[model samples]
Structure formats: C-alpha cells, structure tokens
Target: MKTQIEQIKVKNFRLYRDLHITDLQRLNVFLGANGSGKTTFFKVFNFLSTCLKDNVTVAVNREGGFKELITRNSDPEKNFIEFEIKFRNFEQGEKSPLVTYHLKIGFNHGKVFIDKEVLKYRRGQRGKPWHFLDYSKGIGSAIKNEQDYDPKSKEIREDQPLGAEDILALKGLGQFERYKTIKSFRTLLEQWLVSNLQNEEMRKIGDVGADQQLSMSGNNLAQVASFIHEYHPDIFQTILTKMKQRVPGIDKVDIAINEAGQILLKFGDNSFTAPFISKYTSDGTIKMFAYLVLLHDPTPRPLLCIEEPENYLYPTLLRELAAELREYAVRGGQVFVSTHSPDFVDALQIEELFLVKKEQNQGCSHIFSAKKYDDGQISELYDNGCELGWLWQHDYFKGINP
Candidate 1:
C-alpha cells in the first residue's frame, strides 16, 4: 500500500513553540537557514515515529535524551512536546485513506514518558473521532478486566484505573491481537524510517563490513551495491547505466568484496578494473552513489526523510536529484527532504515547495506556499532563470526588486 505524510503540527517543541504544517505534497521540501529549527522539526517527527514503533529509550538515545531534547523554555511543571501527523494509507489495489495520529511526550522524574497518543481515520476534510491508542489519564486494563469478568456488561469503571504497565500491556495486546491496521502502520515506520546517525562515527570511517544491509552514514554504499549485484542484478545494472549517463568518465560500476571482508567499488577501465576508494572519491560521486543505493533498492519504504540532500553535490546534479525525487513520489513513495538548495527547488513544482520561516519573538514558526505569496513570485523566479538559494539571498521574498 502507498503511504505519505500529509501534515504535521508541533507545539512547544525545541526551537518551535508552535508550528502548523499543512502544505504537504508527494515530494515536500523544507527550506530554512541554519539553526532556524529546520533539522529540529525533522527530528521531532523522527523521534515520535521511533518512540511509537520501538521504545522511548531508542528515541532518547538518538536525540541525546531528555536534557538535550526537551525545549529550553519548557515549563518546569509541564515540560512536554506534542506533535500530530496526518498520513495517507493506501489499501492493496485501492486508493489510500487519510489517517491522523497525535503524540505527546514529557519529562517525568528525569525519565522521558509518553503522555498522550491517539490515532484517527479521517472520512472527509474533517477528522473523525479519534481511536485512543494510549492515553496517560485513561481507564485501561481495569476496563479490560471488567470486560473479562462480565462479557455482557461492557461498561468501563471510572474509579478503578489501570497502572502504567497494565495500560501498556493492553495497548500492546490490542496492537498484537485485535487491530492489525495500526500494527501494520507501526511496523512500517519501524522498518523504513532508518536514522543513519545512530552509528555516525563508524559510517564516517568507511569501516562498515561487506555484508551490511544499509549504510550507517552512507559508508556502506559499496556493501549495499554488492548486495544489489548478488541478489538484484537487474536493478544494480539499471542504476549503473543511469549513473554512467550522469558521469561521463564512468564506464561501469561494480562492488568487489575483498579477502578482508571489505567492500569496494571497482570502476571499469578500458582494459582493467580500477578500485575506487570511498574516502578518495569525490563528494558528488559519493552522494550520488548513496542516493542510488537507496533509490534502486528492491525493498521500497513507505516514507523516507533525507536531511540536507544538497550537502555534497554539484548544482547540475542537484537538478537531476530533484527530478528523480519527483519520480520516486509519483511511484507512490513519500519523500520529505530538507534543503536550502535553489537548484533543487527550481527543478520541483511550485506546489511541492514549502517555505519555512521563523518569526522573531513570535514563539512559533510559519510555513507557507512559495506560490501563494504575492501572486507566486517565488514560483516565477524558479520558472525564470533565478535559483531558489540565490533568490532568497537577494531578499526576493522580502518584496525587494531583485
């Protein structure tokens, strides 16, 4: 089934006191300056999805725990971060339906805890009554116990409340036994939402072994390529062909697993195979390979979030990347990318571009469509010769005559 994130709303979460994001298309792009809370916003969604699928421990560890993650100006008595995400879940051979999920986490006695969680399926433009998945202040197992005692009387007791563990057990049982749809959604997030930063140091060293499935920080690109070669040879060949078109000098790409169990990329020379070292590879080449490894993989993820995709790529390649991202979205994979690259934005549809800006002393963030502002000047710039990054630099958004 195809799935895509439709919207996200955040409250009292790190640099953002309040953030409402409604402009979400298949290929959504967030553009903001450094330290303007762009990555933090992505982190919030990542943390929430991880916590729901795995555990609080995994989420906290990924974000440096409560002290580092919690909002600096958070109220001492009620230090909490809340977010809501709306997603479209497609059924097999059927069109997808919109589903909204809400989550809240807070610090309690120095331990991070989920305060509230709810999932709902929307019928139309308005949201339906939420199916309460996990509510901190709700009658949980006590009601279950009551139901077990008397089958006819399906009434919940108000006074007899379930403890935390009991509530969690009931929720787990509900996911495991009763409701398969919610369980499927949870599983999707757990499996597809890969955070490479979990092993950042190892990835940077390019020491990832040959048999690894996915690269930590894209260091295992060769390993992934090798896996593709052995298992999905057709996809690997297709990627190589496409890459050769982009990079003229590259005759062919191959992954060689050496005796020491290290995987390396071997470029075909006129007469022999030349081993290309990852560390010595150009940044553009490395980034291109990393992206190809993900895109051409046989297993498709429902949603993929990439941070700063413009980090190491030429402006021309950024345009190609943007086009490929669009194709990925068209094929039913939701792609959310955060970038400040104008070339990348120029290659996208105006509706797919979202402008993220921070208002001084507003204690919140604003997201607006680049086309909806002032009769679509931003879109016009992209339609013309101006690149997105340069337009912003020239104060084009500030009503200046750039």
Candidate 2:
C-alpha cells in the first residue's frame, strides 16, 4: 500500500507540549504567527528523518541537544520527548491495516537514548495488533516472516541488538525484506523532503550532474533541472510551459556549463536574444522555477515539508502555487506546508488548513483544524463568501495573532 500519515501526536517537543492532530488531509497547510511553532512542527519530520539516517543522539545534538530540544519547564527526569505517527499503506491493497510507529527519546545522565520505539499493525480486524518491531535503548526484537505472520499461531522473532542506545531499530531491521512494513516505513523516512529553499543558494553554480532529488536548500537546482530535462523530457517540458504561463516573459528554462564545468541555470525570455543566467534572473522567477522543478519530480517523495513557500513569489502567483502543491499531494505524496500568506490560505479548503496557536498562560502550542475551529464558524464564514485569508487577517481565526 502507498504510505500516508493519517494522524500525528507529539509531546514535550519544544513548544508542543501535547499536540494531537487527526483527520489529516493529503494537502495540509499550517497558518500561524511567528513563534507559533509552525517551524517546530516541520522540524519534527526533519528530526525523524535524521534519526533514521544517522542516530538519535546525532539528531538530538544537531538540534542543540536535549535541553534545547525538549519543551520548556518540563522535567527531564520525568518527561520523554515523544512522537507518534499513524499511517496506512494503500499500494499493497486497500485492505492494508493502519500502522502506528511510536518513538520516545529520553535524556538520562547527560546521555540520550531511545526510551521506547515500536511499529505495530493489526493484520485482521479481530486480532490484536502485531508488533513488527519493538525496541528500547539498544536492545529489541523484530518479528520474522512478518508478511505472512498469523496472529493465531506463534510468531517467530529475532533479537536484533543495535550497536548503540541512540541507534534507531529501523536503521538495522529495515535492510531485510522479511520485515515488509518496517522496510517501507524506513524507506519513507529516508525519502521525506523538508525544504528550506534559499534563493541565493538556488542561484549558485554547482557541479554538473543529474540529481533526481532536490537538496534542502535547493543549491542543486541546476543539477536536478538537468536531470529532469535529460531523463524525463515530458515532465521538463511541462515545467517550462507552466513557467511561461506564470512568469511574464519566461519562454524557457535551460542549463549551461561554465568554463569551470560548473552547471549554471539559465532562463530564456521571448524578448531577449540571449538567455538569462540564474545570477541575472529575478528572485521570484528563480524561486518559482525551483518549486516547479521540485513539485514536478516524476517520483515524488512520500512526504514533503515546506516552510513559507510564499516568500519571493508574487502574491498573485500564490494561489496557483498552492494549487500546484495540492495537485502534487493528489499524485500520491503527502505535503505539509507552513505559510503566512493570505493569498495562499485563500486557495486552501477548510479541511486542508490548520491553525497553530499558543496559550497565553501555558506558553505551549496547539493545532486546530480550520474545519472544527470555533464551533465551525470559520467554515461558516468561508461558505458565506468570506475568503480564508481575509478572515485570518481580520482576526477571525481566534488566537492566531496573525
């Protein structure tokens, strides 16, 4: 089954004391003021991906260690930084059961370790959920032959001990094919993209090559653009055609190699005899093209987390960009976006929007779906000819402080 996250619960992670969000749509947009934890929410995905790629300790350290990473005023001795993601696979078949992956990281004696990590699924509606992989600290076991395991019969297991307490169990067990669920989940984590695109980085010349995926900062935009142009010409042409429609004079986007053999991204204009290099392209054009390249990838990432994509782009183009993001989600990839733009919110459906706000007293963040907020008045306003962005700017989304 194609993997898609249905729900997420986070506890004692930075400003999120206990945030539980359900009924997640394929295209999820987070709207909030600064310090409302929108970036922190995206970091959760980055942290999880890092843990799988490296280790829990490395991930924690990358975020300035446990003290800075955990919630404020929380007792480290008692509380654990926890995350729970409930997702289901649809590629295997529609009958695939919901699967939950839970991880708890604790700090003890100035050292970080996995307090508890679990991946479980119920094969049948009547039976107990099977723990495909279970681990705490460095020791754990995974069920062998999980693909054909019958809950009624005794399940075979193996004691797979990780080299270190901070090591993720999925990092080890995901290698074997027998653990189908674990392997898929691990692959999903490894492929999830969290973009923090820097326009300056996108314009920089880079080594020549075909990079199927975009980097976090999009410094490799030229390479990825080259990749699509060479390997997937149809997709590349679609991107160019879309660009021409969006940008006033953009006729084509091409690649060039400098004398140093570095790849220089180029843009063609209908009025100009010569193409414009990325260095001379406007920020909005470079940023928009980078996004088109990312969204048009033939093999989309299982999950994509992008923060503030409205930056650099013209406000008039935000609605269209938002639509493109939604279309990408419709193509089997889950997307999480944080935006401060009213134009972008105006393009979102109530179910696709979430408001992140913080309590004045508790100083912790909470997420409320736009569909269920304020007794459904937001939906009422939306239905009564009020745009979501206008409602937000006029303080209709209470406590948003935007």
Candidate 3:
C-alpha cells in the first residue's frame, strides 16, 4: 500500500497544547467551527515541510521564531516543541513494517536547536523496535543498510554531523538514496501540497516556461495549467470535463503564451464569442477549476492539505467536491480537508469523519472520530434519514457552536 502515516502527535506547537490524532484514513475529513484549531493543526505539516525542504532554522523563522510557534505562551512546565509520526510501509502488495519518527526541539540561547530525534521501526512480528537513526543537536549516527536485519545488534552504523545544530538531520541525510526510510519520509514532506488558494493571485500571469507544479498558496495557477495542458493533455482534458460538469457556461479554458513568454489563463463562456480572462471569471468558477486541476495533476502529491474547500464553491457542488477528494485519495494520494460546510460534511462516511472542537474556558481541544458511536445506532439513525449534517446542526455534537 506504499507508505502512509497512520498517526500523528503534536506538543507545544501552535494551538495544540498536546494533541494525538490516530486511525488516519486515506480520505480524512476534519470538521470544526471557527477557532477550533483546524488551521493550526494544518500548520504542523507546514512546519515539517519547511524543515525538510529548507532547514529547521528557516522553519522556525518563517513561523516568527520559537516565541510565536510555541503553543499558549510556552508553559514553564513544558518548554520544548515536539512532533511524532507513526506510519506503515508496504511493498509488493504486502505490509512491510511499522516505523515511527520522533522529533523534539528546544529554544535556547536565542536559538532553536534539535534536542532529540529518532527513527525506529519494529524489526519482527513481536519484539522491541530498533532505533535505526538517532541524533541529538546534529550529532549522531544513522543505519546505512536499512534492509539488512540480524535482529540482535546494529548493522553498518554511519556517523553523521550536520553543518549546524539548527539543521534537521533528516533534511541533510535524506538526500542520499541508500537511506531508504529517510528518503521516503523526506519525499513525503517535500511533496506535500498545502493549498491556501487566493482568487486574486490565481488570476495573474506566471513566470515563463516554468515546469510548474501547484504552489503551496496556489499562486502559480496559470503556469501549472500551462504545464498540464502542454505536457499531460489527457489529465488536462479530464480537468476540463469535470469543470464543465460542475461549472456552468464554461465550454473552454484557453491557455496562451504571450510575447513575454508568460502563461495566461482565459475562460470561454458560451454567452461571449471572445474568451474572458481569469480576472473576469466568477470566483466560484475559478476556484472549482483550480481544484479540478489540482485533483487531476499527473504526478499526485503524497499528501494534500486543503483548508475550507467549501469557500467560493457553490453549496450544491460541495457534495461532489467531497466525493472528488475521496476519489483522489483512492487514486493513490492521501487527502486531509478541514471544512465548515454541512453540505460537504453530509457526504462523508462515519469512518472518514472527525469532529474537532475547543473548550471555551481552557481553550483546549478534543478531536474525536465520529466512528466512536455505535454502528447499530448509526444504522438506525441513517436508515431513518437523519443526516450527519442535520445532526450536527441540532446540537448532536458537543463543543462545536454549529
């Protein structure tokens, strides 16, 4: 089943004082009201991506340094930030093994540095997990040959020293192919596509002739559209087909390279013989088309974090959008979506849904799966036509304001 992270734990990072999310599915839906930590939760991936793509220092600095990144004013009792991921790896149609990577960092002497980091996995059916890679403050060794396992002792340990204590060991060592585990984890982090699509940005022209993948904030929409249309025509056609089905009066989407060699996106409405430029298209149309393009990319990302996909899209399309996200997951990419729309939530199954809420007084949060409810109870309620969104609206859920 390839490699998929089954669980994640966060401590002293952003709004989550300490949070553990488990039983993660391919198509995970995170439901929460305003200020319930949905965006904060997504920030965890942002922090990790920055660390892997750039460095820990850059990650910290980008988030306004440790002072701003820490959760709830860094309780004197808890002074460090930590994140842990437990994932399952599979190869050749069989489950390979379970692996866990844990990272802890502390801010000291006007700087943030790695206090501890470890990558370990279970060696056999029943036994203590082996620590294949262990490092502290950029000093330590990692296992070279990850496949060779004698089960009693370590094999081929290689000393690794990063250029700086503020650097992430995985970021430095993950470049090599021999360290399969490190490389895989790094790829997942680096390839994560987090969307904060701005409609205004999507309307502008992008740099010339860039083999563009969708950017994190989705500003390179035109360039990405150009890339797909020019390189992967089939995928682009699929996007156009879906776009026409969901969006009204959008027969054709034209992409042209101007004299400056920049790509421009134009919309062709049936009402007009001339095509309308991106800026002239309706917000909902542009947003939905961007989503279709993203979901149908030729090289799908390992993880896609889209916050509030319901925004700017027709309420009626929410259900179809939910199904499309799930389809993307089934087609081999994991999806994480946070939404406030009941229409979108209505389309989700019990196992794929999570309710996230925060306590009023303490500002602490609880994220629980909807699957915790009894199956018979669900069968009875759903059989009676009691939809999940209707239930949510009627105060069936606690801590959420609806």
Q: Which pairs in model 1 have colliding backbones?
A: 90-96, 342-389
Q: Is candidate 2 or candidate 3 better by lDDT?
A: 2
TM agreement with the true structure for every prediction: 0.80, 0.97, 0.93
Candidate 1 at residue 214, lDDT? 56
Residues 1-402 of candidate 1 have per-residue lDDT tens digits of 477677888877667777777768888887776666767777775766666555665677687766666667667347667788887666533555566777776776666656766665533455343342435643432222221322233333223343442122223533553444456467556545433422222224333354435543665666667778888889888888877877656667766556766666766534445645555556666667677777765766677777877776788888888888777777766777888777786677777877777665654566667767557777777788776667766777662221
lDDT of 3 at 367: 76
Query: lDDT order of candidates, best first?
Result: 2, 3, 1
Candidate 3 per-residue lDDT, tens place, 1-402, comes to: 356778998888877778888989988988888888899888889889888777788899999878888877575234989999998766424656778999998887787788888988876767667676789998988987777765665677889888888778888788888888887777888888778888988887887766557786678899889889988899888888888888888999989878988788988889888998887888999899889888887777888999999999888999999888998887878999998888888888877888787877776776777766443454356558877787777766655674
lDDT of 1 at 97: 58
Q: Candidate 3: count the clashes.
A: 0
- TM-score (C-alpha, index-matched) for candidate 3: 0.93
Worst 10 residues of 3 by lDDT: 373-382
TM-score of 2: 0.97
The lDDT for every candidate, in the order shown, is: 0.63, 0.91, 0.82
Per residue, candidate 2 scores C-alpha lDDT tens digits across 193-238 of 9998999999888998878999999999999999999899999999
